[model samples]
Target: MRSFVRVLLGLALVFAGTSHLTFARQEFRAQVPELVPIDEDTTVLASGVAEIGLGSALVLASRRRRLVGTVVALFFVAVFPGNIAQWLNRRDGFGLDSDEKRIARLFGQPLLVAAALWSTRGGSRQRS
Candidate 1:
């Protein structure tokens, strides 16, 4: 079950990252935090690259799953602020135009964090 969840998460990240690089690039820009110094396109592209790298790592590096999961968890936490910024700024994107949807989303991030950690043991040294 855990492995399945981890794979699901990995695939989701890849899909999202691909969206960031392609069709949904503009929509994703709406989620970028206002205070971030980088240009919106740069933020999107950089994050897309990070997501792909992290996702690919999660999927392809089974032996490195501990490290990859930790990175994925931290990456989710890092990008969380963008979720908040979306709500606070009331910027509509990804169909989260309503404040209610955005608020609910804010609470879902920790679950992603926990899932990553629990699934991969999050940096723990594996018993060989």
Candidate 2:
């Protein structure tokens, strides 16, 4: 049951992350034009691809559950800057729909990270 939950959670992350790639590109370009100044769309697309790949790896790498958990945790930490940017800059183009929703999305980051960590830990324990 724990393994099942872990895979489900991991797949959910992958789906969420993969889906955001396109939205992020469009929204980031509209909200923060400066991103283009750094580089072309290639960089943004690469980042999206990396996020999807990492999420997929977490699901597949069940044997190395600890490593997967650490990777997911680091990924969450790394993406936190974008969340803060959205919050501080009030980038309305991020598709958040409203200020309250945006705030909730921003705050949800840590919880999502915690969920990933918990899933990983819980799954690992069941294996032992």
- The candidate scoring highest on lDDT is 1
Candidate 2 wrong stretches, greater than 4 Å: 20-24, 28-37, 123-128
Clashing pairs in 2: none
Model 1 spans > 4 angstroms off: 122-128
Per-residue lDDT tens digits for candidate 2, residues 18-51, read 6557645666433333443456355456656766
* Model 2 CA lDDT for position 16: 60
Global Cα lDDT for candidate 2: 0.66
lDDT of 1 by residue, 1-118 (tens): 7777888888889999999999999999999998999899999999999988887777776677777888899999999999999999999998998999999999999999998878
What TM-score, computed on C-alpha atoms, does each candidate reach? Answer: 0.93, 0.74
Give the C-alpha miss distance for residue 117 in model 2, angstroms. 1.0
